[model samples]
Target: MPDLWQNICLHILLTCPIFVNVWSRHDHLYMGLDHRHHHHLHYEKDNDLSLWINEMQVKMFSGFSMKIFAIDNGKVSPHIKDPNFSMYLPTIPSEVSYVNFTWKSGAKKYDYHFDRLQSLDENILKPPSISIKTKGRVPRNPKEFSVFLPCSGNVSGVAMFSIGLLIQTRKGKPLPGTPLRLTLRKECAHRGVYDRASLTASQGPDPECDKKCANNGWCNHEKICQCPEGYMGQYCTQALCYPQCQNGGNCTAPAICSCPKGYQGRHCEG
Candidate 1:
């Protein structure tokens, strides 16, 4: 009996390592033991017919990544990078819709399905703006994109203006440009014809204009408009008179002029 017991103990010890290894592998296969939690699925309920995703979460796996796609009425929306990304849905007759989430782990796949409530808001269904022309390659370096306005008439009473150009890639670290293009879009009117005005940016305006307007004036291609002290107007067309004169007195380009009891000059100094 002692010899038999000895033999049994030896057999058990020899198989212990093998059993442990098999159990570990099985756990990995069934419980994602070897895989990291790479992505998450989340949804929201709405009172209307359109289903919108209000939150999403995701993480990177050791050797894998994840993407999300939303399908509505049999049409697939664009793939979103994160589950938290919000989605706006179109109006539908039914208040509830179906959503499916497909998760891929290496060669393995998992799927989840849920019923999502849709709150169809007419305001949310309005199509995004497709009118802005965003063509041409975005500059690799600090390149200037400009719009030319032909006449001052086009700019007057403009109230607001904006233009957008698409950016393609970044070569080095990205620093936002002043007059950042993204924020400028909101200030622009949705639809309006603007008179052509040429826009260019450099260290300074044309060298000739710089030299011409050197003494506090603006040099145009054809002429220079010297702005007078305390006054700024088109071609010096108008004057800035402060402490405007009352009682029929004309204000000069800078100072207020009190005319004789009968006559009024721009500057009462007259």
Candidate 2:
């Protein structure tokens, strides 16, 4: 007979088939996160996920994305690649601790090899005086922003982003152990400014969509509703139709296609 501990582990593995957690728990290793990507969840049901010593590889089918932040101005940017891979936030996060990630996104592949976060250039960082002054004061509203990195994906090989930090001296000199460039990356969807998103999204309501989401949807940075499945329309008030209504038909309810006159099939094809 197996021991109680082994049985418990086996039970968990059997019950939680949708997700997995891989960890090392080392005290020294660190993985900094950008202000945009916080969730590790996905809609991929048929995919292979593996975690070896210090590397992670996921054969994803439905979604994948990543981002990098400018250390100096606190500006975040997305990593653009061919055939976009997007996903909504607000799901259970998978705990996959690895320094490197290989996203086998079918035809379009993305490989990320994240090194330890170290020093970056001083040109992009705020002055040391400002840093020293704002040491312990966490802002109610962080002044960081996210933008798309143009041409960042057009590299000879895998797009390289070195997300680094900088520690300056009193006289504005780059400290001893920092890099010459800054690379702070993230991967997320529905991260429109203001609305704040899932595990890794901002934490407050944006002013543009203030009092508009009505507890059913998330307002994106564009002041648009990023609704959940089954709901649609401005502020997510209308129901969603799967195969959308026909040429002139309207979606009257969830999965309900209101066909136009003379159209008589489920999706109005007949």
For residue 100, model 1's alpha carbon misses the true position, in angstroms, by 58
Off by over 4 Å in 2: 1-210, 218-224
Reference-based TM-score of each model? 0.20, 0.24
Error of 2 at 166 (Å): 21
> Model 1's lDDT to the true fold?
0.24
Which sections of candidate 1 miss by over 4 Å? 1-177, 180-218, 222-229, 233-238, 242-245, 255-270
Question: Model 2 Cα displacement at 68 (Å)?
Answer: 27
What does the lDDT come to for candidate 2?
A: 0.29
For lDDT, the strongest prediction is 2
